[model samples]
Target: MRVFQLGLLSALALASVPAQADHHQEASSQQAEHLDAGRWVTLGTRAGPVTSATRSQPANLLVAGDQNILVDVGDGTAGQLAHLGIQTAGIDAVFISHLHWDHTGGLAAILGLRAQTNAPPRLKIYGPPGTAELVSGLLASMVPGATAGYGVPGAPRADIQQMTEVVELRDNASVELAGMTVTVRNNTHYSFAADSDLARRFESLSFRFDLPGRSIVYTGDTGPSAAVEDLAKGADLLVAEMMDVDDTIAMVRRNNPNMPPQVAAGMERHLREHHLLPKDVGELAARAKVGAVVVTHFAGREVGDPAHLEYLREIATNYDGPVVIADDLDVF
Candidate 1:
């Protein structure tokens, strides 16, 4: 029942340009020392594929006992890490909840940067069945850069394949990762019929991380899902995505005024069924009985808009636990 917001000091220090750069380097070193203590940092909180003026895309960093794991590598994730005084090469592993472009857009940057730097301890990417193919394609794209080797004549070419390892996870899969036990459940983001080939091929997953002294469940992007609730049950923290259905639909219509009415209607249905509204989030939190909730992956409201507070109010109606509407860089 306690609530706190972190990264205030970092935010203040980052406001100054020259001073911030120096401080960031110092902080990065300091952060490395305490990473084994375990914490969750919301690297990017904005929802969907479109960029925002105030928020970055959907990404999070999980620091679990000497492991730096990226929960989702959305676009701008590398930049978000840089802003927090962390380097892309520092990420040891990544857990992708789904294969949506918005969730996996930054994989190229993470892979490319790690390859360019020739960092040791090859990165491990854990995701759904198609993840290997996704990483394979990204690795193929890096061949030219690896061959160039910064224009150094006779220098050994970087082996991009050696720099990354992909582990594809399926529904109800569990694995040990860097002293943490990671489990995943298939969620309702995609409504493919069970027992169908499409269902077997594609899945949207919710991940539960059981770390030393803490348990966290991340609902990547899902509708109201009993599987997600079961995955999150009794967890220490539930980092869930929340959507403002009406506002999001409005934003979509505004952006595509020429879109057909039927198309818009279909989109609305998808948003309603495939995403969690504020109240849905509250109910899930309540049902899961998580100790605390940190809401990220926000959509449908402008940054600094008062209307955003309505989400908190709606969530409060069902859940009495500590709930935080997180911003980029917020740690919990």
Candidate 2:
């Protein structure tokens, strides 16, 4: 697989300002050759620690085939998509794993790009629960000329992407797309967006795409949950988050005064309730009988030292399948 580098810009800066429009096009176009892959493309491929905190990679992603979908578009997703040489309007649907700013920040940018393109078709977006509102707001916020000539708006975009038919899944259910329905269901991952009071447990989600030759699961920012195993059963790929379990425990143990105890507790709770440690993920993949695994959504203390990678490797040992640490722009 080939990887491409995109110029630096914030999601807000990229969308709010218009001066960079030409730059987004020109800069992204240079990497066209690098981006032209056989089948799949990582429009934005960064292992994000949190929302809008990527210093190394973009969060937007593109999977093109009988279907064209953008997954978890993050802060620089707009520029990243441009860099990857994908037309925003041409995109069929956007599948957001969760409701986090970092993951969906470029949503507005993509819309802006659509406005710029003004193509024959619009765009359709699929998300867990609050997806429609987020997409609606994002679409409403774009500047007019952004996609006027490139394509149609909203619903029309769904037609070109092969998701013309709408299939609704139960809260924790799975559905397929493009002649193939992987599994999509809610998981233990919970966030403020899912719940306002933050007392009662909330619902986040993951998706498994079981294609003819490939089966992949995107564990969208989750904690340890058995639901994942149910969806990931026998998957060819597992795009999971990488929060080291030991690291999580260490953070709890350190309990520095600089760290807000409430925030720490909240984080700890989230990790406990919503995410998976590297080792735990490996075990899940192994138990699920997956063929290959790709881990992502890496938010934790710096893993620069060989120790972190070693930890990942150790955890992955549980799974007999091939394991790859997904960085930004790594295509499988």
Candidate 3:
């Protein structure tokens, strides 16, 4: 399932810049992997909370037999589902990778839209500890506007309270639902000191979904983690987040040229520790022996960015498996 390869040395700084000649290689090979019926489809691939012209924030749709599940509900998730001709009400459950806005931004929309139509008994949402509180806050903020149709004359009342259910998943939690076996593990995305409040209050998670004959692992924004590798071991597909370290630093510099040295250094540290570089991603996938890797949550990748080919080459250095640089709506 491998695509292209390179014998070039691992050059991070130089690899950040796009090469005009590499665009054709990407175009020719980008569609190498195709989604079979009832498989995974990438709904959004962009990282960060900000919306970009190239990709959506971070979301994916999984069709396992009769079940329709959402991996993460990022911004524009509803629209992407509509674009894919999937009904919002048909989602059996949503797995929130973490509480980051980019991963949970479309949650309210999902709740509201489904309630607008034939609401399910309860839309199950699984996430870390703060999920209940987060949903409470969202509902509070949507008081007047989102709840306006609750009791309109000649319209069926929508039960905002019972319309959704939040399930907080802890590390090592395993469950069976939606015709799949779901196992969860905590990842090292939010790295804070053990005694710090941030560490105590925030948790990042990765999920593994096992169907009858296939397994998929979604590594929600994380640095290199043994837990993630173990969870994704021998998976049929690994959907992961990848960042270009050099490009990230360059992007920060371009945005804030006059930023303080300490602040800039901190930004670089976060990029290195909080996100996966292409090499790290490749090595992780290789070590896990996953059948293929579908890279989402692109941090510094732009549409038609030729530097992305170098990224693929970097991944190929370690992984001999297929690496699909996913765009919004790409299915595999």
Best model number under lDDT: 1
Best model number under TM-score:
1
When sorted by lDDT, best at the front, the candidate numbers are 1, 3, 2
Ranking by TM-score: 1, 3, 2
- Summarize candidate 3's per-residue lDDT along 48-159 as a digit string, tens digits: 7445887887998787666678988998899888875666887888889899898999888887778667767687888998999998887676557555565566665665
For model 2, state the Cα shift of residue 89 in Å: 2.7
Query: Can you give the TM-score per candidate against the true fold?
Result: 0.88, 0.70, 0.83
Which is superior by TM-score, 1 or 3?
1
Tens-place lDDT digits, model 1, residues 1-332: 11143222222111211214454575675554544436778888989845788888999988776667999989999988887667888888999999998899998999898887768756889999899999999999989988887898999888777877888888899999888899999999999888999898989999999876567899999999999999999987889999888888888888899999899898888898999999999999999888888888898665478887788889999998888888887767
> Global CA lDDT of candidate 3, please?
0.77
Better of 2 and 3 by lDDT: 3
Residue 245 displacement in candidate 2 (angstroms): 6.4
Please provide the root mean square deviation of candidate 1 (C-alpha atoms, Å).
Answer: 5.0
Where is model 2 more than 4 Å wrong at Cα?
1-64, 143-176, 191-202, 245-260, 300-304
> Distance from true position, residue 258, model 1, in Å?
3.4
Task: Indicate the residue-level lDDT of 31 in model 1.
Answer: 51
Tens-digit lDDT string for candidate 2 (91-143): 77777777767677777766665654554454656776666666666554553
Which runs in model 1 stand beyond 4 Å of their true positions?
A: 1-37, 260-265, 302-304
Task: Give me the displacement of residue 167 in model 1, in angstroms.
Answer: 0.7
Error of 1 at 208 (Å): 0.9
Estimate the overall C-alpha local distance difference test score of candidate 2.
0.58
